[model samples]
Target chain A: MTRLELLAPMTGRVVPMEEVPDPVFSEKMLGDGLAIEPSEGLAVAPMAGSLVVFHSAGHAFAIEGPESVSVLVHLGLETVSLKGAGFERLAEVGDTVAAGQPIVKMDLAAIAAAGLRSISPIVLPQLDEGWRISKTNAATVQAGRDVLITIER
Target chain B: MQVKAQAYLEALGGPANIKDIEGCITRLRMTLIDPSKIDVRKLQAAGMVGRPMIIGKGVQVVVGTYAELIGAEINKILKQK
Candidate 1:
């Protein structure tokens, strides 16, 4: 299995990600990835890959890149209803992205007053492979921070 | 806050049984292990209150916050075999 390099969604605090179970771990609990306080200002690529699973709402996307890595980004609550009204899609499906590449942007505060969460989740689907991947601290991250998640096969 | 849900990767007869696992508008869409071990009643019991929905060929659990944790645990459990 090839190693998939993952990156932190934001330069936020790198605390130990809790191992939650059942109803507590669902998307609904986070209120559509809220508390992370999303923004219409900008949602950049945490890594390079095919931009798959861009919700019609334009608030979320699932990116697939090298090593079969899948990264899902949910922008805000019900922001999908905006229907791409606020966010600007920087790239199209199957397009390759690089670390720190700009994908979308908008106002952060405005997104929350509207009643939504900003907690973004960076996930790895094929994380089951027998490889060694290490993640850094989930500190308050910026777009271009060197938050490397290297998976060694 | 607090959450709970039932997770399965082995019930599908190991990860080999699943073609893919993804989430949608509400439910976590899963391509299953023969779709035989997918007992809605049993899955629901594991989830406490949230019921399981058969969306298309995928058997889904209404995992809220427990979604990620359940997923994490499933991944760990599956990797052990």
Candidate 2:
């Protein structure tokens, strides 16, 4: 089976989702993946796909690609209350995005001042049967450069 | 001081209007019974930083870092009745 690699959507330190703190994500209720303690203010598309779900708040988004693989990019822990103050949307729903294309711009300083952690969780919500997902061991990842997820179908 | 989650919930038309609640690092994501019921003035008064967004069947409220705590509180309220 050929392995499909999903690159990092943002630059940050990659941590296991189990460290996310929020039970929903930590327990893999939303799906299994890794989290990033982001250092930059921008998030890009990890893979070329069409945006299936785009929140107006720019806090979270879900993209669906071929082979029934869907990925969710959630910014911060509880930043939904920031109400898009520090977030900027670069793409809209149904837009076709290329891998490494900027999709959201954020003010990390502003988010920190608001007392929100800028830890982002990138999850694969749609894992079909017989598909295996694995995480890369890279401690720090660069957007469009490092492959954080490897999938074998 | 930022508005308490309880106050925000009250201004959001109570738990009855809430269909579901989820939180990310900086926001309180919710599914509301009626998006029109949201009072922007009250939300701002309660210390929300930005405008609310209605996405599909859900609404997202920017709650900063305390979003998870607030989410937990909301869940507690939901369980009560």
Candidate 3:
């Protein structure tokens, strides 16, 4: 059965990427993805797949895994507008990025000194139309870590 | 609704400097400086439109496809800056 899978978008602790509910305020929050600063190291493809979307700034990407999982990487929220000013594009659209391949290298100091965080967001684009995503306990994830919810299609 | 929306935008540092906004399935992604200062409730209460969800110890706001629209609004706002 083709199942859904997640791969590490960055090289860092594969902590369970989850949403935090501020019970006091009664709200929920999204994980910043693998929280690692730019250039602490390079973010790699968790798995080899087709590059579905690549932002112009070269900070984020999406991939449809071999198992039919869609993943998104928001490198730095507003950084996209930087227009590749502080980031270097390591891969091009339609290019097959290999797992653990070097996609882009960032200048962490410049980003932080400029008051930006290196924490990026890697997400499963959708919950397959007719299916519910099943998951195990959230674990610390590193680049290439298998931390994903399988869509039972 | 107008008043509530303003309150949230203010908490998010107002409609100023907001260059873009977008989200994944569970987040109302905001791109701004010192993201640490975001008052999600203020933004939510201000009627930005979206539900806040808690997944994996993080906060997310639902903006739907309008997320891109909000982002464009932000971009337009940035042009003046």
- For all candidates, state DockQ relative to the true structure: 0.07, 0.07, 0.08
For model 2 chain B, the run of ten residues with the poorest summed lDDT: B62-71
TM-score of each: 0.55, 0.68, 0.53
Question: Model 3, range A20-98, lDDT digits (tens) per residue?
Answer: 1222111212212233323354666756787766655666666666656566666654565566667777787677777
DockQ of 1: 0.07
Candidate 3 has a TM-score of 0.53
For candidate 1, lDDT tens digit of each residue in B29-77? 5777466666565555454235555555677655432344455455555
Tell me the whole-model lDDT of each prediction, alpha carbons only: 0.52, 0.81, 0.52
Runs off by more than 4 Å, candidate 3:
A14-39, A129-140, A145-153, B1-81
Which stretches in model 1 have alpha-carbon errors above 4 Å? A1-3, A11-40, A77-85, B1-81
Model 1 residue A115 distance off true place after TM-score fit, in angstroms: 0.9
lDDT of 1 by residue, A25-137 (tens): 34233222212333235667777787765654456666777766566665554454455566667766667778667766645675666665545545444344476657654
Distance from true position, residue B64, model 2, in Å? 22
Candidate 2 local lDDT, B1-81, one digit each (tens):
223777888878887898988655446778899888888888888766557777766887765444656777778777888
Which digits, one per residue and each the tens of the lDDT, describe model 2 over residues A1-153?
A: 756778899899999999998655686655689999999989999888888767667888877877878888888877777878999999998999888889998899999999989999898874777888889999999988899998887
